[model samples]
Target: MRTLILTALLATTTALAATAQDASNTLDRGNWQDAASLGASLDSADGYTIAAKATTLGASVSPDSAKAALLKKAQSYANQAIKLNPNSASAYFELARADGRLAQYTGILESLGLAGEIKKALVKAIDLDPKFDEAYVALGLWNAELAAKGGGASFITGARGDQVIPNFEKAIAIAPTTIAHRLEYANSLLLLNRNSNRSAAIAQLQKAVSLTPVTYWDKQDLAAAQKKLDALR
Candidate 1:
């Protein structure tokens, strides 16, 4: 944060999309699977799951493979994209996202080390685009997850998870209607301080469930949000 944010303030906020805000316009789903082989030709959509609904949601219903092989494949594409354009914030963002997925499968100690890399990448993405609310959501998730870990875990990564609420609120402030921001904030609340924040979490989830979907990913998230809200209720 200190390194990347300092640099970003000095640098211009480049308007670039890491993942397609609207998939139809910028994302080409046809060649999505070819990202591994395509290398530098990767677009903002390359590293993300083509079927996030199936890949993520399926894991909830059944024990899907947890190898994170697809995430690593996506990482390769992000790596190539970074090599091709050093200044591409989207590339860095994808790389960070991939690292996060890998950490989920790899375990906590290894993921703790990877947190630094993820923080740097997300910070750089924000440096490139100050209004990158998605990046903020990612940042909030990072903090929230680490905060959930607590104590030595936070010290290891220099993460102030207690202060993660501002990150979530900042994203929500920037784009009030974005269900993702609300859903993620609700998650952070429950993860960090569940007992006290249960009501708040439900409130955010309520807003999230009521919102309309604007992208394919949004539909998946909305479904998850409703299920989660049901459980909470």
Candidate 2:
């Protein structure tokens, strides 16, 4: 009787395994490309997902061989998204981001022109979608980095600090939950306050360290900011 029971249990387990394998195979056979194409045709979230995945993969991959393939794929998806919906500011912004990442990987001077073009495209994106916080964030960073001599201090000051602070503040106002936006804003404030407001700069760096996420880059940046604040102290 015991032997018969063991035999039955083994058969049942084998049957269940076979059934699970069949289900897995069936799921694997589903046509993702067709589904994605349909989503693209209908202007659905799946299309955005595809583009976002491509962009993320492009950014995550190495700069060496076969990595360029991922970037090319990202470019293709971004272009497809833009083609599918010309009115989508997010699509253009994502395309610009992908291009910027690629430019960064491939010598800044070599791609400076492309970066400038992407910057211009982002401006158009903001004009099209004024409420887009990501676009504002990108514009703020670009302006901070590309600003003329003296860290664009003269230009930003002449503009009543609105040109820099307002853009970063707007991004923070729109997306209070995003730590990146806050960190970027704080970094910009630190630069702006270097000569005029050392105490304010230290405060901003402290806030940046406090608000940043616990990722590697965030932790590193937070540490650096804290170190600077300590030096000021």
Residue 64 accuracy (lDDT) in model 2: 67
**Per-model TM-score versus the true fold:** 0.76, 0.58
- Compared to the true structure, candidate 2 yields what TM-score? 0.58
lDDT per residue (tens digit) for residues 13-63 in model 1? 232233232222322332332322332232434323222212222233333
Q: In model 2, which regions exceed 4 Å deviation?
A: 1-50, 57-69, 148-162, 189-202, 208-233
| Candidate 2, lDDT over the whole model | 0.59
Residue 19's C-alpha lDDT in candidate 2? 50
Query: Global lDDT for candidate 1?
Result: 0.69
What are the lDDT scores of the predictions, listed in order? 0.69, 0.59
lDDT of 2 at 139: 71
Identify the candidate with maximal lDDT.
Answer: 1
Best by TM-score: 1
Span of ten consecutive residues with least summed lDDT in model 1:
49-58
What total of clashing residue pairs does each candidate reach? 1, 0
Query: lDDT of model 2 at residue 65?
Result: 64
